[model samples]
Target: MVEQVSVFLENTSGRLAELTRVLGNAGINMHALMVADTSEFGVVRIICDSPSKAKAVLDEAGFGASIANVLAVEVPDRPGGLADLLETLGDEGMNVEYAYCFVRPQGSSAVDVFRVDDERASSVLQAAGFRVLGASELYSS
Candidate 1:
């Protein structure tokens, strides 16, 4: 299982920089990040090589953080790939709370990481022809 660290941050100056600085100071590497903001706050979802360390750093810095189990699904870097995966998840009765994608390596394609509301992830992967990658597989160097 991949554990994603979701941090609630204020949409103010230096908020994001502070968060990243804390993580960097703690020697935690953020592999990928996605930020969704409203008028007052932002939800920063990050995939780090060391999620526990990242969480500890955020806590020490007085930031509220949460960890969620997500599925790292490798998909082709073409159109309809995401739609197909979402449709499959819908058919399987799995609701996606949020999702983000990162480019795979220089030679590889892309990988979509999804945080599902339900734990029916394995079934979805098997049925959708997607490979479920573990946290180490996705984040570890």
Candidate 2:
């Protein structure tokens, strides 16, 4: 399990830079991130070493930041791997809300970070033979 920081920012110039600057100044290191934008606003989801500190700085900086639990699963870095995982989840009656992928140079496989409707996603994925990573595992280089 990993704690993701969801930062809600306006869809304006330099907003992403500002957010990064805040985190940088606070000594927070980002492990992975994704940003989605709408006409008026954007949501930046981030995996960081210290989510609590990140959220605190963002909140003091007047950004709407919150924490969410997401499962980081080690998956094969090949086609059909994601499909197999998704099919398994679907068969288990698990609903994946959203997901993203990243690869570490030292790792042999890619990791898929999934936000699911089930709070027991970590256990579910583990029981299904998935390599569910802890926050430390995800952050360690």
Candidate 3:
């Protein structure tokens, strides 16, 4: 499992930039980011080198931030890699709540970050021949 930092912000101009600036100023390097928004608010989920520090900095900067555990799995950088993974999860009765992907700096594979409903997702996926990444693996390319 990897730590993900989630920040809540108003859907206003400059809010996103301000959040990024805060993370940048704190020297937190973001590996992956996904944003979900409504008309009035937005939630920014970030995979970073220092999730705890990132949340702390965001809080000090007046942004509501929290940490969550998410599974980071290695997937082949091929057309059907994602589909296969999803299929395997479905076969095992695992439901994915949300997910995002990012390619590493020096790899032929992409990492898929998932917020799944089951706690056994990591073990199940590993049994199904997937590499579940921990914080060190996720942060260091």
Candidate 4:
């Protein structure tokens, strides 16, 4: 499971810059990130090389943070690609709490990291036509 650091920030200007600067100054590398915002606050979820370090830095900076385990599944970069996977999970009675997708380059495939309610990720992956890639696998290739 790939661990993600979720940071809560005020929905104002310079908040993201400050957070990134703090992490950058602390020598933390953010590999992937997703930001969802409400009217008052924004949730920035990140996958970094050192999740604990990132959380510590955020805490020192007075930002509310949390760490969660997510499943990084590689999916085909095409229409209905995600639908196929979702159908499989639905068939097996696995609910997807939330998910985010990111594409590599023009020549490579895309990857979607899903945050599931339970640790039924293995079963979901086996049932779906997707490959559950580990963090090492994500870094290696």
Candidate 5:
């Protein structure tokens, strides 16, 4: 499992930049990010080098921030690699709530973030032959 930082922001100009600026100034590097939104507001989910610190910085800066446990999995950078993982999870009756992908710079693989229905989805994925990364693995990568 990994800690995913989520920042709630208004759907207005400079809000995204402000969020990034705060994290940047605090030296928190984003490993992955995804935004889910409607017309009024957006939820920016991010995996960073320092999740707790990032949450604190965002909160102090008046941004609504929270954290959740998510899974970071490594998939081969090939066709159907991701599909295979999803299929395996499906076979286990696990449903993915949300997901995003990022290429692994130092390896021949891609790292993906996922919000799954089951709390033990990570362990299940690992047992099914997938590489589920720890928070440290993502931060270091």
Candidate 6:
């Protein structure tokens, strides 16, 4: 499982800019991000090089931020790659509550960030021949 930083922000102009500024000032590099919003507020999920540090800085900057454990599964870049992964997980009875994707620097494969209720999903996927990434793999310098 990888640590993801989730921040709550108001749905106003420059809110995202302010959040990014805070993270930037802390020298935290955001590797991936996803935003879900309603009329009044938004939930920003961020995968950074240092999750703990990111959360601390965001809290100090007056942003509501916390860490979540999510699976970073590497899928092939070709067609049907994501579908196949989801199908396998479904067959194994794993439910994906939410997910997001990001391309790795190598470009050979894309990493899918999956929020599953079961922590064992990572080991299960690895045993099923999928490459479940770790913090070092996802945040390598």
Per-candidate TM-score against the hidden true structure: 0.91, 0.92, 0.96, 0.86, 0.95, 0.94
Better structure of 3 and 4 per TM-score? 3
Note the residue pairs that clash in candidate 5.
none
User: Candidates 2 and 4: which is better by TM-score?
Assistant: 2
Full-model lDDT for every candidate: 0.84, 0.87, 0.91, 0.81, 0.89, 0.90
The residue-by-residue lDDT of candidate 3 on 1-141, one tens digit each, is: 899998888999999999999999988899899998999999999999878988999999899999999999999999999999999899988899899999998999999999997988888899989999888887742
Q: Name model 6 segments beyond 4 Å from true.
A: none
Query: After aligning candidate 1 to the native by TM-score, how far in Å is the CA of 141 from where it should be?
Result: 9.4
lDDT of 6 by residue, 31-114 (tens): 898998999999999999888989999999899899999999999999999998898889889899999998978778999999
The superposed Cα distance between candidate 3 and the true structure at residue 74, in angstroms, equals 0.4
Give the runs in model 3 whose Cα sits over 4 Å from its true position: none
Best by TM-score: 3
Which candidate ranks first by lDDT, i.e. highest?
Answer: 3
Candidate 4 has which clashing residue pairs, if any?
none
Score candidate 2 by lDDT.
0.87
Off by over 4 Å in 1: none
Instruction: lDDT winner between 1 and 2, please give it.
Output: 2
lDDT of 3 at 97: 89
Report the alpha-carbon TM-score of model 6 versus the true structure: 0.94
Across 1-141, the per-residue lDDT of candidate 1 in tens digits comes to: 688999998899999999998898888877789998999999999998878778887988899998878888888788898888888888887788888899866646688888787777767676667878887677763
Q: After superposition, how far is residue 76 of candidate 4 from its true place, in Å?
A: 1.7
Which residue pairs collide in model 2, if any?
none
Task: Rank all candidate structures by their lDDT, best first, as comma-separated numbers.
Answer: 3, 6, 5, 2, 1, 4
Q: Which ten residues in a row have the lowest lDDT in candidate 6?
A: 132-141
